[model samples]
Target: MGSSPSTLERHGYTVVRELGQAVLVNSKDGDQCVIKKINLREETGKGSGNTDVCDAVETLLGLSHPHIVKHKTAFADDEYMYIVSEYCSGGDLYQKIKEQSEKREAFSEEQILDWILKICMALKYLHDLNVQHGDLQPKNIFFTEYGMIRLGEFGEFNERARQAGSTKDGALSYISPEILDGKTHDEKSDIWALGCVLYELCMLKSAFSAESTVKLIPKILNGSYPPLPHNISHNLQQLIEETLQTDPGKRPLAGEIIWKPFVLSFLTARSEKSIDELNDNLVKLRALADGLEKVHYGATVGSLTGGVIGAAGGITSIVGLILAPFTLGASLIVTGVGVGVAVAGGATAGISNITNMVNQSTDRKNIRSIILEFQEKMNSVVICLQHITEGMEELKHQISLKNEQQSPSGGTIVKVGTRVSRGLGAVPELVRLLQVANMGKVAAQAARAVRVAEVATGVFSAFFVALDVFFIAMDAKEIHNIRTTKASEADDMKSKLVLQSPEATDSDSGADQEPKSETMKFVKKIRETADELQMSLDELKEIISFIPKLPDIDA
Candidate 1:
């Protein structure tokens, strides 16, 4: 092994190995530790601020928290500052996410909430101390044994880097829009970065992705990203939306995020109950009751309504845009008018749902009946969801068949009404299901019941987006079909010419073909739609997992 840095060597630390950005060292006391070597020559070369750099490193040694990495000591030589912190054996969050991404697996919603809450708690501690982690990304989020989060690589090192005009440019994907816009870093900016982290944990990819920093700046400023995988909870999705808001003022502070109803309830359930207690559904129910007691019932209903209306409106708007060109300006006008009407109708429906919830809440004695009724409706919704998924799968199969058939003449025309747009038929069914669940939520006492309802609504919302994409995919497939037909005609002519040649053999007849851009585009659409639908189906199946097995009742 290479010799330890002089700063570490003075402390009787030997270099065990070199890590990517730090050194793994063995202390004389027989403990494995990490020594982060920060070069201080650049800052001191200006002939000042050496004392300030030392003071910054010293401050981190005094910081302590359950979720913060434990710093043992800090010392500096003339050229470098070395800080020793406890080594986290379980690796970091970035590695875990990368592994899961490679495996094509996703973290469960409960697991995601657990991780984010721990991170939020750590962040709140830092914020309360008037400290901001200028650099917060998955790589800096370490984990101890049993997967407890220990925030690392924070404090003076980050501050110094920021002062040196190096604010984690490598982690541009996680940088907040405000920072990209040249605003000073603040706690709110940390919230924005955390949102990016949260999105990564859920989707296994950076929320904002681009080929270059120049392309990425506009993306972050615009702050629009593809939706989270459908298997993620709507509440979680909503939380992410709030956190990633481009307007720093709108983002929730770390403390407020910790206290959100979903976070609080989920954390309580995990911390307050043993696996055995959770297995006894009634105990789980009791725990859920206590957790949700702090939740605002009306707000929950309102959020559900908001999600529903937002999804419906987005779908209608997309539909209008898709059909606008066909009608010239008339369809655009109609779409504008239709969207206004839909918004009005959706608002009225939301108010009605809230009113029903209020009326139902007054009758606590009817809780069991209310849950049973909700459960019954959920059964039907589950069947409806399955039917919809199956229909989409069949539609995909039909498209695949169309893609495979090599017609020399014009390709078989898709039936007029056979477009994936017909998937819209499930919208009203889903709406009615939401209304029933809304009524059930008002009267139900258990968080599980509420979660099932939320998941159902989330499935509907995800499906709506899928339906919109499905339309675009169908259009792409139509173009692809026409192009393939023309290409096939040319190929058929070539094959005929080859067959007429005296020297032609089976091998001679085969020619290598170049990739077609339209075919690739269509294939990409197919993959996207399939992936999207599969993810949504996985989310829908989670409802089955959430629904408890009730005792059989006498007829």
Candidate 2:
């Protein structure tokens, strides 16, 4: 515990105790808190920004899972930080596990199962937000005196941690395979650790017990999970197997597991508990969505606002879009950054349609199937670019029109300033809506591009077949006429000979006609060969045409 008797006078702390690298204190109202101060002056300064602190606070605020700790408030002075969060009077899980071990008992089956399930909910929530809690273990989990579990200390979190190596400091037995193999860590790694914790809770053992980090890494990368007792339920055994899988791709996602009926049937069988967990998760997600909206809006808006102020003698398109004042709601626009909403209007030009776009979120399934998926997206990008160009042109004209109406009073420069302010006041919502449409186009492109190769192959194959058909059609009439004419000529010659040589005998006529019959047969075969060649050509061309004509989606 961190209770500094000396600094307690100034920083408003009556008590402090050093807990590892952190300082814990008792609030004036008797509430417990911890302060993990970062010495910015001594940091590695990866980017030399307060992003580290901002990211930490944002992550803590974003999680709403029951297993995660809730941050109350965080404010910093030049020297140290004061991060207030829910204090678990029951203390950390490690202490509880130790106490239980001393009694020659392990956590009950239900308690372990319940805790693991809660952990899954928390992990699912963080991943949904694209935020990751890199450090997870029994110590990070706290059991409240009120009979609750809370995940804590997620301040140094961000999109970056979602990948791995966010920090060099980490635990061993719970480490992910990627981490063990010198690969970047991601949420899958967290799942691996969750498996480790689950294993310990069940077997009362670590997944890998090693003397040092150096030895632990290799063993984890190739280690086998400790054998489970036969008494463990088949359902639980399967769940453990999925969680401990070495291949990240093969591991089950929280969504994939939580929805299952048999994986942990006992937990779900308790309808009341399951309902509570679901409700708690919903509350957490709503909170995170709110916080993220604010963070993203604030961080991205300053630049856009700055651009508004920097308008000069040249560009008018921006001025036009900025001149119309509009209300930017949070669901549609957070601090000026907006999302898509469903549009009631059928057309793109109306305010209702723009409003709909501002309210929408990116759809995920659109990117899965073919190569045209790629080209189609690219083509959409091109269409967006054209729209943007035209929109910019109209914007310039609007700016010019507004400026022209100003009186000659004051001067030209005054006119410009007024126009600049006026434009800044203009259709912010509209511009944001346009930005969102472009986003749709962007999404469409990404999904389409993902399947570009597949689309191309299919198109190419179809094109070649179409060409073969066309060539066969062109040759059909000519070949048929040639064969018919040749047959008619052979019959006519035989008839004329018969009429002019009425007196000739039957044996001499039959012998003389054999050579002529062979010639007609050869002619008919040649015509048939031509028809066959044409049919093949048509097939080849049909396949050829479709191959290179893949869809082109825009960027």
Candidate 3:
């Protein structure tokens, strides 16, 4: 359905070469791109009624992630449609795998883990937004000149494959058992494909294969695959086994496996500072929140004390102005200044309490509002500090003016002078404490952002810890041969079922249910432990639930 090569050259692109169905091209501006030509009618054929490839292409153009190859644009001319995307120079991983196979060499564990993590990262990104890379084979994976891998050939290509019928040689090797049983693919299906990819990386061969599709179907449905090499680590073996479970319900999610202890340990050893920082920030937040609560209480108490002292002084000064003739001018000024400070401090404290209540009740869904509220609280503290400073300065000035006018004083005036001096000195210390509280507010907001990221990834720290525990259990001698244990259990169950009457067994709905495997039972226990740990963490979080609100004199 494609037109002449000259027709595409007229569209400001010069074809450098052809790579399969795609042409490597360079724009007049020196931009390198790959344009894949597809015939819409041919791919869909008659009565398929599937024309959503255009919409999928549009979606691809909107996606932009480091691990995903960028789709620049798409255009159609008559019967043929073309998609333009950024070209990767290092070719697809399928070629690399084939090369390594020829040499009879397996990839290093580090390199394999690195690629797995990258692929999962991209998958998690898409799955978070309810998007799926339906065709996620090594042939669709690409690498840059600098050796950074990226996931390409997604979106529309997957839709096209479904319409065209997936009949490519060796393609059935990666198809999950559920798909063979007439079930549609989902996120779990991607995990199954990932398992196959991992197996190839380790064994340098397909996980399942046969002379033809007929024989291959039974091998996949039976879930019988060659064991991993003895050199492979138990953790990686367990991961591969879990992902390739014939029952999708038993499969670990992409989010779960991404944070598996093996993957996490690898990332930690590599010192991925960005991930390290997320964890570090969470720890800092907990400590800062504790310190912030103490400072908040201290500030509240200080504001109350300042208010009380100021009110008492204002009342005493008014009485002094009425009774003492010589101190009339000074006492009048002190009365006005004392009343102003008392009102500002007390009102600020009251408003702060109200704001804290409102913030505590706020739903985290409105994260923008919460951040803005914290910022507003910081600003209010700055304003309150200014007001208190101004009031203190006015009081000090009036006291000095009164002393200059008067020659001598009794112990009563001496006591009053001492109290004023103490209050003035405390202002700087309170300002420092308020400033620290502001820092705590900032830390709390950052911690909230980290929480958002964790949620988006659909993983929890406790879950990872639980995975570690499960892996450690797997290292036990009894648990080492997990597949053997599973086979023995299956045999025992089958023998017990054979003893029952055939008619009764056939009619029983529960007969179709496979016995709960040992692996799944152990996993259920680990999940329970994770739930317990998460609950405990939730309790700890409640201890620092209240974000300290600063007093606002302006309010």
Candidate 4:
């Protein structure tokens, strides 16, 4: 009987009989119905018994497993909880098999197909969702009146059962070796259970039967997977053995297992199959991958074009700046000086950044990213240089508005350097007739480029203030050197003239005495050193101060 007295009057389910704590009932709605009293207070060491059941309810309500019974609805009274589910009229698969085998009744191979494949698919699906059915006895799966198979009784399902039980989650007959040996259970354990189910469906007997759970556990560990009765196909036997493999990691994934050619070959045994042909296909796939690599090589070349475009545009701008003096006169000095300062600043720092990128790049895997970074910076410097050239050209245009067009004395290839002073610092015009290139070592290319780029940016941005201050001080020292050397020379000559005249006999002769010959030579050498030092200091100050001022125009 599936329903009780009050429950039947309300829902129209006919009570048939009672089984222990549950009632057998028939749904008047022309559908099979089974209702069981739920025991929510049964505690397992994992957590609150009520908590596990609540979680299981959440999982079962959303799933539509074929081998596992679908939850229709649940309710509870003050005395007991009620669970409504589909009922199999053919009785439990377990009782039927026991009845058949005990009576020496024959089973069908065709029925085996329907039973085993469906069970395999259901197990695979549950495994994919990380749900394990701890109990996989035939009693849970039943047949309809028309012999349609249905699976039921999800209360002892593995995932929840494992949480409840400290050790085993499934029946002793079908548990995998890993779970028996206390390993963490996973999807492969489901495959092992499916193997047992397949064996039972073929043989109409339990793989390892014992009167008690403890003895049956040992029989399972020793691989007494359900007996393969005579006349079963070799393909099926090999598949079951493979699924029963001890190592879970070695098992084939479900999708891979289901579509093996053996399944198809089992239908048509004479079909040709070659291991060599599979290997050949794999080789061709790798070759096709190589062609994709070839395509990427062509892409990296784009970064090189970026470098060339940068070099050309830089030259054009600097040349245009220098031409402005003739083309614009005094206005060119103001505008040309700005353009000149910009060209020097960008070349010094901008090229250094690219050079670092080119030099530091070592790892080929990251080379593509480095190439991309280089291309972007190259474009920025190119455009900045172009703007500078344009500014020089604009000065020429303005001068042309006041007069006629005038051409520069030389091409971009000609060397140009000049020293000029402004609050923006000494702006030195440096035009390279050719590149002052430093080809970098290729061993650790990316790291070298990154390091160089970082150093260039850090020194110029973070330390520019300190550097500029140092340059200003150096300039003051050289100016003092020139004045100091002149003053010393004038005093030395006066003392030498006094020593050769009547003043030599005086008590204060120390003041009138001529300096030693070496002292006179030292004074002459200091004058020469002051002039040379001044030239070097002025050039350096121009370079340092020019770096910051170059970006004033719309770069």
* Residue-wise C-alpha lDDT for candidate 2, range 94-179, written one tens digit per residue: 67777777787867777786777767767777777777667777788886544456776552442222222344344566778887
Model 4, position 529, has a per-residue lDDT of: 31
lDDT of 2 at 472: 36
Worst 10 residues of 4 by lDDT: 414-423
lDDT of 3 by residue, 1-555 (tens): 235687677778888887765789987655568887666777566544336667677788888665788888887776667878987877888999999999988899888977877787678778777787877778888986445578987634744633244344456888888988998888888888888888888888888988888998999998889988788987678778888889887777665665332343354333233333333333432332232232223222333233232222223332343323322122222322223234642322332332232232111112122222222222222222222232333344434544454655522344333322323233444333333444444345434533433342343334344334433442332223333534555555355444643223222456344314222333343334334434433432332332222222110
How do the candidates rank by TM-score, highest first?
Answer: 3, 1, 2, 4
The runs of at least 3 residues in candidate 4 whose Cα sits more than 4 Å from the true structure, single-residue gaps closed, are 1-14, 27-31, 42-51, 65-68, 103-106, 155-170, 210-216, 224-230, 264-555
Angstrom error of the Cα, residue 164, model 3: value is 7.3
| Error of model 4, residue 399, in angstroms | 76
Error of 3 at 431 (Å): 39
Q: Which lDDT values do the candidates have, in the order given? A: 0.54, 0.46, 0.53, 0.43
lDDT of 4 by residue, 1-555 (tens): 223478554666677776534566776643446676544444333456666666676676666643456567766554334667665556777777777788886567545654665565566567778876656667667664334455555535433323223443236677778888999767677677667776776677766778788888777776765556557776566666666666776555453344333331221111111112222322332332232222111112112222121222333332343322122112211222222233432322222232232222121112122222222232222222222222233222232332221245422211111000011121122111001111121112323333443443433243223323322342334334334534565455344433443222111346435422221222222233334333332332232222212222100
Worst-scoring 10-residue span by lDDT in model 2: 362-371
Once model 2 is optimally superposed onto the true structure by TM-score, how far is the C-alpha of residue 420 displaced, in angstroms?
57
Summed over model 3, clashes come to: 0
For every model in order, what is the number of clashing pairs?
Answer: 0, 78, 0, 21
Best by lDDT: 1
lDDT order, best first, reads: 1, 3, 2, 4
Candidate 1 achieves a global lDDT of 0.54
Off by over 4 Å in 1: 1-7, 46-48, 155-169, 274-555
Q: How does candidate 1 fare on TM-score?
A: 0.48
Give the 10-residue window scoring lowest on summed lDDT in candidate 1: 546-555
